[model samples]
Target: MQNRSPSRRTVLTCATAVAAGAAGVVGVTAGPAVAQRRDSRLKNILARMSIEAKIGQLFVPYFYGASATSPSRLDQERNLEELGVRTVAELIAKYHIGGVIYFSGWTNNIHDPHQIAELSNGVQRASLALPTPVPSLISIDQEHGVNVRIGSGATQLPGAMALGAGRSLSDARTAARISGTELAALGIHQNFAPVADVNVNPANPIINIRSFGADPRAVGRMVAAQVTGYQRSGVVACAKHFPGHGDTGEDSHTGLPVITHTREEWERIDAPPFKAAIAAGVDSIMTAHLQVPALDPSNEPATLSPAILRGVLRDELGFDGVIVTDALNMQGVRTKYGDDRVPVLALKAGADQLLFPPDIGVAYNGVLAAVRTGEITEGRLDESVLRVLRLKDKAGLLSGSPYASRREVDRVVGARGHRLTAARIAERTTTLLVNEGGALPLRGRQRRLLVVGASPAFPTDDTRTTVPELARAFDGLGFRTTRLATGREPDSAKIDEAVAAARGRDAVVVTTDNVDAASPQRTLVSRLLATGVPVVHLAVRNPYDIAHLGDVPASLASYCWTEVELHAAARVIAGRVEPCGRLPVPVQRADDPDKVLFRSGHGLSYGTV
Candidate 1:
């Protein structure tokens, strides 16, 4: 194996490499007039495309293989059959489907970078065989920190909240650049990321740690930097869930969320980050499945509202790039419209691309029928097709060979330098919120330590736990460690069992996950604190756990459950690394009514004490 770990000098060299590569990624820049003239090729291509091809350009359907257990060699053939095509080339020749979104279910081999690159090449070859030879725009949800749709061949960075706490615009750029370069190496063209939503609502179940932080200005700046970084690395950067999904309590995956803010209120709070994203030259913006009566009086979600998608996003914001809908299969859109009607409504509502339509065949036929019956005008359809073609042209899909080599993919994806960048961000963002009685650094002669709480696991990852890795770190420090978890809130018997386990321990270290919402976990921590043992609580998920912990002598927030973050927390405990991270999001105690326990931007350094 290669030495895998790089020194600081090597990391800086990687940063400079990114800076050099960025200048060539989004290389084409011309004034509005020159840009319009450049679209003549796109227009000529559109003039040649048949009605079926034009309609196909508007739809991006998802493809998942028949089973996850299928071998890699059989996947393309199996997927073709499942997609109702005899061969890969027939997908374009027959249905003329514009693009296919790859889900993990698409193949068991989805995580292999070499395999992914080969798949991209195969798809491109199929597209090239068509009469028009227009290459497909291969895309993925490579949103890091959270929702990494690609795995095994990618670096797992700490989530958006960690980046918020890291608090460096340059770090934001470097992180995005690293993510985009790996994606491009895998022959992926678009990254649906750098979530622009300002996470103001702590109760928001979905966008919690995925968002940068609660402050609008900070979110705007960070997402703007990410947009620049991604586009400069040759991947289309999509700022999503516009105008914003930050404050809503509902998950759009299950139901259509309603945001009741007025137009002025939206401008003040929800609209700033999106505005910044557009200003940063974002290539695409994904519409939210949200209903804002203030923007559009109709009950329809933004995905189907012309007033929101066209009037607000396009006319007001002056965005001329591709407009994509959030996955149409989600209940947010599916519940309102039938399979056939969803794509038609989205296109009419100004979406340039219909992503993840439930049934590609039905959606394609429905769009073709609408255009022929005058339900959708030919001119209207052409406008979106032209925009799609322009984007494809800008991405160099029309001009250059859209194939990546396996060797390059191996060299770039999750390379040592990129891993180092992720580690540095993880190290810097682990915030220390409370140390009431000099309880951290484990300075005492206590040789026995008890570790308790939730198993360390990221919200996006379910395979491994950070507990064993964390235990080994403590073991390396010469502390005899005991690990315990009741799996749920302990009853009398379970509590007695835990108390027995804690009897001989000198100090207790508890790792918390979502304790703000998990009352049983909260109660368990309080009970442990009452034992008069020095309990040092490490919150491994949401930082709001500090609110529930309530002066537990010592508490730290990791904002993630990844190994890099866990190891960083262990180093903080062992006094090898100082805890210098500040809180990016505020914490409010349920017992206190008037004040925040720890304000946003508040962090403590060991040297300061």
Candidate 2:
């Protein structure tokens, strides 16, 4: 799954004047009169747009393939006629799409930096060739850490909670700036990142490690810093799932979750980070596909609720920027409105951008028909399209040249300096949660070092693949290590094998992700502890596994399972680096749900190991 080029080297290749606009660097410097002229031009463009074209300007859809003339996945999925067009280039030209979102893997829209740069230029060229020539904004979800979409050759910085654990706003800013710089270089104008949801509920299925932490102030500080870093780096930063998607146990991608926060409580927990992002001049705020009865009593999804989007987010929070709807195809937003009405309702709800409708044609016609029938006013339609144009102008897309330098991709992206910064950030994110009887830091041991690894269940992965890399991480440090991959979740056979393998080892390290008290991972760790062998339980996703496992001999939370993060964890175990990361959220006592086993900001360090 590495995004390789024609050559077998890394995927970081592509270059020249990026976002914020210098070559691949975005620079939009305008005074009052300059701003006035830019707005005048965009307004003029809007005035000339036909009702059909104007509606298209409000939609940002994703298409399959790496070129203008390739096959499609969505066309087959929908069995629709409009999507029958060949290649994403055709989709853009045919629909006059205002924006395009790129995804790697299944969509195959991106492969390497060069391929992505070509696609960026190709799509932009297609849009500009139109008689009216509306430049489309290119965007992606390069959130870094576990939620990353773009792979290597890009700096994979620590996730939000990991940065929160580091407690350094400067590092946070640097990480975002580096990530933004590379993404902009690839011609991606918008980055759906810096998750602003305050993760108050540990059972929060989606936002756990994606959010900074539970504390309002901490989340706000990191969110504001990241937003500034991203904008300053020339990529438009979007603070998302507004009003809060942090407290709900259900994930909105599959199910509609309701947040019952009172207006006062919402202002306390969920509002601060968004307020901070707005203060920092975030370009957009994405609406959550969930219900907030406290904000809108009608119980409509936030994406379709005028009370929440127009009332709270617009009037109360004062975010004059573009409000983009979360994927309209998701069940959360689709359940209440049919395909035709969803796009129209989002505009009515104050969303300036309609993202990923099931069918782009259906969405376009829906909004167009709504305008013709007076269900939605032209004035309302004008507001959203104008905001989109302004965003384009802000990204220097309207000025000229949306193409990324194919040659420059290699030098600017995943450069040595960026990799070092990522490594340092990873080093600062290793939170030592438990260390009983000094069981960790197995240095210079005579016996072979035994390892039992398991992958996190949240993001599906096989620990067996990472075993060689893990062994190499320790082997590079001059230690003889034996490794075993017990799958993501171990059965009786794997556990028995792991216990048997640990008989004469210095220490046993097992990686856990969201494991529970009754889970097989708990049984594995307990068996390893009973064998008179030191055991280290590593929680690679959420730190809450320690609380659930209850009284493990030793535990550490890397907060993610990235190569750099795992290497940092290995260094800490070998006494190479001190674990400075504190708990971003409180770890509750398994026996008592009301009481905490380890309070927030708790971290253990080995002295003179």
Candidate whose TM-score is highest: 2
Per-prediction TM-score? 0.89, 0.92
Model 1: lDDT of residue 8: 39
lDDT of each: 0.76, 0.79
Q: Mind giving the per-residue lDDT tens digits that candidate 2 earns over 1-609? A: 122222111111111112333322232445677657666767777877777777878888877777654445563343235465666667777777888888766566766777777777777767765556776788888777678777745767888999989989999999999988888778788999889999999889988999899898899999989988887887888998897899999988899999989989999999999999988888899999999998899999999999999899999888888998988889889887789999888898889989988888788888888999999888888888888877776776654556677656777888899999888888898888888777777756633677676754222223324555566677887777888878667899998998899987877778876787667878887888889877778888888988877567788998887777788888887778888998888888788879988899999888622
Deviating ranges (above 4 Å) for candidate 1: 1-24, 66-93, 105-109, 444-448, 456-461, 472-480, 485-497, 592-594
Each prediction's Cα RMSD? Answer: 6.4, 5.2
What range of 10 consecutive residues in model 2 has the weakest lDDT sum?
A: 7-16
In terms of lDDT, model 2 sits at 0.79
Off by over 4 Å in 2: 1-33, 71-82, 456-466
